[model samples]
Target: MCIGIPGKIIALHPQQADCAWADVCGMRREVNIALIAEGDRQQLIGCWVLIHVGFALSKLDEQEAQETLAALHAMEEVEADVAMFLGAGEKR
Candidate 1:
C-alpha cells in the first residue's frame, strides 16, 4: 500500500530551491518541496508536511501530523504482532 508519511521541515537546502531537509521520525532526508513551495522558504521551517516518494505532497497542521504519526506507529505495532504470530506458527 502506498502511504504518505508526516515529516517536519528542518531546513532549506542551500543549493536546491525545490529541495529541503525534513525530519522523519528522527532521520533527516532531502525532500522535494516544489509542489508546496510558496513565499519565503524559511517560513516553512517547523511546518509539518505529508511526504510520499521523496516529495512533499501537502502541508499539514500540527495536530493532523501528530495524529497521522500516531496511526502509523499503531500500524507498526500491529505489523510486529503479526510477524511474531507467523513466526510462532512456523515453529509449530
Candidate 2:
C-alpha cells in the first residue's frame, strides 16, 4: 500500500521555486509543492500537507495531520512486532 505521510511546511527551497522544505516526523525533506502551490507560496509556511514520493499531494488541517501521524506510528509498531514474531519462528 502506498502511504502518504503528513508533514508541516517549514520553509521554501532556497533555489527551487517549486519545492519547499517540510518537517516530517522530525526529519527535514525537500518536497515538490508545485501541485499544491496556489497563491503566495510564503503563505504555505506552517501548513500541513500530505506528501507522497517527495510531492505534496494535498493540504491538510492540523488535526487531520496529527491523526494521520499517529496512525502511521501505530502501524510502525505493529510491523515491528510482526517482524519479531516471524524472525523468532525462523530460529526454531
Candidate 3:
C-alpha cells in the first residue's frame, strides 16, 4: 500500500553522490536518481518520474502519470464508499 508520487528532476550534483533535486508541485526535494542511464538523462530532467522509498522507481510520461493518479484516486474513493455503505447497512 505504499504510495509513490510523481516528480520532475531539476538538477544533478555530485555532492549528493547519487541523487538529484526533483520538483513536486513546485516544492523542491532531493531524490535518488542514480538508476537513470547517461543517455536517458536529458529525457528525465523536466519529465515526470515515479518516486518510491527515497528513490526514483521509474520514469513516467505525462499522460501515463495523469492516468495513474486518476485511477489511484478513484480506487480510494470507491474503497471509502464501500466502507461507509457496509457500516450503515450493519446499523439498520
Candidate 4:
C-alpha cells in the first residue's frame, strides 16, 4: 500500500519556497512545502506532519507521531514473528 507517513520537518530553504527537509523516522528526505501558506509555514518546522503525493496533508504533534510510529512498528514486529513461525525464508 502506498502510504504517506508522518515526518518531522528539520530544515527549510527560504530562497526556494517549496523546498524543505524532513526526517522520516531517522531518514532525512527533501520534500515540498509550497502548499502551506505564508504565516503557517514557519510553524510547520520542527513539527510532525503527514505527507502525500509530495504534498503536506496535515500537521501533527510529536506525541501523535510517536504513537503512530509505535503502532506501525508493532505491526511490523508481529508480521515478522508470523513469518518466522511459518518458516518463511528471507528470500520468500
lDDT tens readout by residue for model 2, 1-63: 567888899999999999998888776878899999998999999999999878999999999
Candidate 2's error at 50, in angstroms?
Answer: 0.1
What is the C-alpha local distance difference test score of candidate 1? 0.82
Give the lowest summed-lDDT range of ten residues in model 3: 83-92
* CA lDDT of every candidate: 0.82, 0.83, 0.66, 0.66
The segments of candidate 1 whose C-alpha lies over 4 angstroms from its true place after superposition are 80-92
- For 1-92, candidate 3 gives per-residue lDDT tens digits of 56676677777755765787777545576788877645645456777888776688888898987776566556656677533322221111
TM-scores, one per candidate: 0.83, 0.84, 0.62, 0.68
Model 4 scores a C-alpha lDDT of 0.66
Which ranges of candidate 3 are over 4 A from the true structure?
Answer: 40-43, 70-92
Task: Write down the TM-score for model 3.
Answer: 0.62
lDDT score, candidate 2, position 85: 26
Off by over 4 Å in 4: 77-92
Q: For candidate 4, write residues 1-92 as lDDT tens digits.
A: 44556778877866777777777766666668766646756777897877665566777878988887677666666666533322321221
Best candidate, lDDT-wise?
2
Cα lDDT, model 4, residue 64: 87
TM-score, cand. 2: 0.84
